[model samples]
Target: MAPPAPARRPYHHGDLRRAILTAALDVVAADGPGAISLRDLARRAGVSHAAPAHHFKDRAGLLTAIAAEGYSLLADALAEVPAGTPDSLRELGVQYVRFALAHPAHFEVMHRPELLHRDDLEFVAARSLAWHRLRRGVESRAAAGRGPDLEQAVLAAWSLAHGYATLRLSGNIPGEGDPAEAFRALARLTFGEPGD
Candidate 1:
């Protein structure tokens, strides 16, 4: 016998890829991207050391996949905020902050520049789609005479949400009372305040 044909693995080891990625996400979430490693991930997933390599060539490949997944998730969150309406785009701003809070692993990978593959096709496509959706919302608000201008509105919303997420992640914004509720309260006050 030819060494029993290497014990042919199962067609699906209870979604091995997903398990590995999930393990990687947990690791990245707790300690950030630099903490991720294939050997550990495989061990956590109870798979062979080479298993993750089959799905992702290396650490960078894993991060790229995580980032792509993050963009897709952000797109879904933005979709929940409605299409039109004055400052409807801001709802997505709120959602973005919330998503980051809920999925720090994905968010970390999505924003980390040196870790992810900039040339990744899926990552680029999903990121473009998310950005276009945000831009369309901003332009619509501007056309409806609610937003100041397209660029300004986009910048305002992006900065506010991104800043808020960073603050939450970095513990720059302290206190209890739920980060999501605090985020919404601050957003309402920020955009709803008087004066142009």
Candidate 2:
């Protein structure tokens, strides 16, 4: 009888979990989150087909991880902008647009709740952090005697930034030069000069 084929070795390497996540992000960037498969991620990462499952459990788990990571990144970006001023609020909107453009895969997956475990603790916490970061500017504006309704201010800012980014990402904004500049002009038009 032929000798049994050599047993397949388990994947062992530097940060297999990160590798799988990165590969999945690339697929997400190219073909949207719905196109990703754990098997495909394994192939892209040069591991056995079962290897990705060891880390992510399933597709939803992988997406929840991505969403959580994305929100944390977004919160960090927002935090980098100076706070507690009208100009800072405008800057936050610009930063929001920048993050979406820079991390299209993460941006895409972060908003699609149907594809993730929305109640996952890490995901919820990250999302809440990002929301609070976004809300900070609105609260600051209210504090500065603008007297804007807190909920409305937050929703307006979010809607503006999110809508602009979604339009640009969908190619609906033709020949948009410099997303930051475009956003700044739109913000100025909508809300007047930052300090107004």
Candidate 3:
């Protein structure tokens, strides 16, 4: 057999944290979250195995960062929904599904709280912001007399969007049309139009 390949030099740079996180996301996208390990991430980043520990500490910590970033991105997407409009709810739901589709790896780690350090300050704050944004969108409709029950409407909208996203990501959705249009049609069908 040929001689063993030499190991890569340990990465030393100003943005190792971002590099490691990007590598982790790539790994998760390619092999699912269960395959992620700090050592593996370090290897992918061409860093010493111990380098990841400096930023993430452990698997949970790394996952938590991914989840936190997902929530932050989700919050930004939902923020585009105009407040106090009945159709804003549907818009928010569409944005939610779109965000999931665009960031499948982040979406996967985000909803699996058990895979992350849920109590991390940044993670908690980001999660709270995303949750509050969703709630506010639902509440806007209720306030405008579009929905009868705030809690029920919130649950229904969330379930509908999340279910669609999950199904789409899992390849359970069937059709030739654009997935975004399919999502919009499903939202209208299930929720009975934006204002209704």
lDDT of each: 0.81, 0.90, 0.88
Q: For residues 72-95, write the lDDT of model 2, one tens digit per residue.
A: 999999998878866877899999
lDDT, residue 133, candidate 3: 89
Query: How far in Å is the alpha carbon of 28 misplaced in model 1?
Result: 0.7
Cα RMSD (angstroms) for every candidate in the order listed: 4.0, 3.5, 5.6
Q: Which parts of model 3 are misplaced by more than 4 Å?
A: 1-11
Q: What is the Å distance of residue 118 in model 3 from its true position?
A: 0.9
TM-score of 2: 0.91
List clashing residue pairs in candidate 1.
Answer: none
Worst window of 10 by summed lDDT in candidate 1 = 187-196
Report the lDDT of model 2 for residue 77: 95
Off by over 4 Å in 1: 1-12, 178-181, 188-196
lDDT of 3 at 186: 82
lDDT of 3 at 127: 90
lDDT (0-100) at residue 44 of candidate 1?
Answer: 90
**Models sorted by lDDT, best on top:** 2, 3, 1
Model 3: residue 86 alpha-carbon error in angstroms: 2.6
lDDT for model 3, please. 0.88
Model 3 Cα shift for residue 89 (angstroms): 0.3
Clashing pairs in 3: none
